[model samples]
Structures are given as structure tokens and as C-alpha cells.
Target: MSRTLVIGDIHGGLKALEQVLERAHVTTNDKLIFLGDFVDGWNDTPFVIDFLIDLDKTHNCVFIQGNHEEMLLRWLSEGHDNEEWRLHGGQSTVDVYGKIDADRVSAHINFLIKLNDYHLDDQNRLFVHAGFTNQKGVEYEYFKGMFCWDRTLWEAALSMDATLGRKDLFYPQRLALYEEIFIGHTPVTRIGYSVPVNRANVWNVDTGAAFKGRLTIMDVDTKEFWQSRPLPELYPDEKGRN
Candidate 1:
């Protein structure tokens, strides 16, 4: 049977990304849902995009727009950035692009431009780089940026009162909107977990490849996970986002 895999933030750790896919025994029959931030951090930012674009030709791939992708696009296409972007692994991407030809740079820009803000599968599971705020669901979301920047949804999930039932008036409405929500951006490593963290119906899959953790991919239905060696080991010479 085909599997639907939800991947965590890559942060340009292409070696780690490749290893986990191999360990997971990923097949072309499987559907890959990337949680974004494919660029920045490591040194292979451009190569990772190239592999992803090529992978899409043979397998079903869903790409969610990450905040890093958005930041990279603005810098590449218009030389615009939020200033803080450089401090958070953005310069690594800039370093790679500085040597890449214009044609490839343009292609990478187009790739970012085409990424989805959020993807809701037939099972009503939402996949986004970050959480949405509107209690009604992503359809009712007013600020699209929240799809790649919001942390409150995951925070709420993490802090959910175990005694709180869905029917309770005080229960978070955001958690009730989807059967399950898969998100990246906020690394679970912040709380000392290096694996996928589940709280309520939301799963935070970012294992902090940008820092000292590993890159991960999870079978959404089975909840079985595969991870690369800790990224620091994969690229010992680099500090990544640390």
C-alpha cells in the first residue's frame, strides 16, 4: 500500500534528508508532503531544491511554503528581506546562490512562488509549515503569513488540558477544525524532544535539523518515523543555525 509521509523542516541538510528517505525505504508510490524550510542552514540549499524539483516528476509531492522560503524569495527576486533573516541561517542560502547561475536562481524563485500555504488531504488532515490561527479552519484564515509563522496553535496543543474534552466550551476550537494537523517551523527540540511530538491533534515534526537535531519523515497514518543522523554529525564543520 502507498504511504503518505509528512516530512519535517530540512534546513538544507540534503545529506540528512537523503539518508532518512533511504532508511524509510521511500518508494515512488509514496506521497511526500514536505513541511518546508528546505533552504537555509546547511550548505546544499540549491542542490536540495534541484533534487526536490526532480523528485516531483516521478512522485506525488506536496510543498508547503515555509517562512524561510518566503524570506529567500524576497531576497532573490527583489533583494528584500526582514533583516533578521540573515541571522537565522539565511546567509548560507545566500552564499550558495551567490555563485549559482541566473537561470537556476530564477527556477528556485519560481519553485518558492508555487508552494502552497497549506494542503488539506481528503482525510481532512492539514499540512502546513506552521499553524493557522482562525478557529474556523484555514479557509477562514485572514493572514496567509500565519500558515508559515504562527506558533500559537502548536503552543495551545502542547498546553492542552488533558481533562479538557472536545465538547467543552473552553476547549481550543483550532484543534477541533481538523482530524489532524502536521506542522514544522517550531522545533520540538526546544522542549528536549528530538522526535516527532504529538499534542492534541497536532504533530510537530521539525526535529531541528537547523540546529543540533536530526531531519525526520513520518508515516502520517502509522505514526512510524525515520530520522537522519543528527545534522551536526552529517556536517561537523558547520554550525548550522547554532
Candidate 2:
């Protein structure tokens, strides 16, 4: 049977990405949903983007726009500069793009430009890079950026009272909008988890590959996951957003 797999933030660790795919035994039969931040952190930003673009040629893949992708787009298309972005791993991407030819740069821009803000599957499963804020759900969110930048959704999920039922007056309405939500911006490692985390109905897949954590891919339906080795070990010489 075909499986739908949700992957977390890459942060440019191509080795980790490759290892996870191998470990997961991914095939063309499986649908891969990537939770953005394709660039940044490790030195393989451009390479990761290229790999994903190529992977799409043979597999069903959904690439969500991450805040880092947004920042990289701004830098590539408008010459916009965010020092904060640089400090957090943007410089590595910039350095890689500097030596790349114009055609590939254009292709990377095209790839980043066409990323999805969020994807809601037929199962009512939501896959987003970050989180949405509006209680009414993603459609009612006033700012499109919130789809790729908001943390409130995750925070609210984290803060929930386990005994609260959906019908309770104090239950969060955002959690009621979907069968499940998969997000990737905030790392679960921040909360001391080195693996995927489930809070309320929201699943955080970002195992903090950008920091001192592993990259993960999970079967959305089964919740069975596979992870790469700690990124620091995979890229021994570089400091991955540490």
C-alpha cells in the first residue's frame, strides 16, 4: 500500500536527508511531505534543494515554504538582507549560491518561489512548516506568513490540559479544525525531546536538525518514524546552527 510520509526541517544537511531516506526505505510508492526550511544550517542548502527538485521527478512530494526559505527568496530575488538570518545559517546558503551558475540560481529561485504555504490532505491532515494562528483555522488567518512563521498553534497545543475534551468550553478552537496537524518550525528538542512529539492533535516533526538534533520522517497514518544520526556527527567539521 502507498504510504504518506511527513518529513521535518532539513536545514541543509543533505547527508542526513539521504540517510533518513535510506533508513526509512522510501520508495516511489510513498508520498513525501517535506516541512520546509530546506536551506540554512549545514553547508548543503543548494544541494538539498536540488535533490528535492530532482526527487519530485520520481516521487509524490509536497514542499512547504519555511521561514528560512522565505528569507532566502527575499535575498535572491530582491537583494533583501536579514542579518539575523545570516547568523542563523543563511550565510552558508549565500556562500554556496555565490559559486553556482546563474541558471541553477534561477532554478533554485523558481523552486523556492513555488513552495506551498501549507497542505491539507484528503484525510483532513494538515502539513505546514510552522503553524497557523486564527482560531477559525488556516483559511481565516489574516497573514499568509503566519502559515510559515506562527508558533502559537504549537504553543497552545503544548499548553493544553490533557483531560480537556473537544466539547469543553475552554478547549482550543484551533485544535478542533483538523483530524491532525503536522508542523516543523519549532524543534521538539527545545522541549527536551529528541524525537517527534504529539501534543493534543498536533504533531511536531521537527527534531531540530538545524541544531544538535536528528532529522526525522514519519508515516503520517502510522506515526512510525525514522531519523538520521545527530547532524553534528554527520557533518563533523561544521557547526550546524549551534
In model 1, what is the error at residue 216, expressed in angstroms? Answer: 0.5
Off by over 4 Å in 1: none
The candidate that wins on lDDT is: 2
Of candidate 2, the 10-residue stretch with the lowest lDDT total is 162-171
Clashing pairs in 2: none
Q: What is residue 19's positional error in candidate 2, in angstroms?
A: 0.5
Compute the lDDT of residue 70 as modeled in candidate 1. 91
Q: What is the C-alpha RMSD of each candidate to the true structure, in Å?
A: 0.9, 0.8
Candidate 2 residue lDDT tens string, 84-156: 9999999888888888898998999999999999999998889998998888988888899998889999999
- Each model's C-alpha lDDT? 0.92, 0.93
Per-residue lDDT of candidate 1, residues 1-242 (tens digit): 79999999999999998999999999999999999999999999999999999989999999999999999999999999665888899888888888999999899889989999999999999999988888898999999999999999989998888777777887898888788999999999999999999887889999999999999999999999999999989999998995
Flag clash pairs in model 1. Answer: none
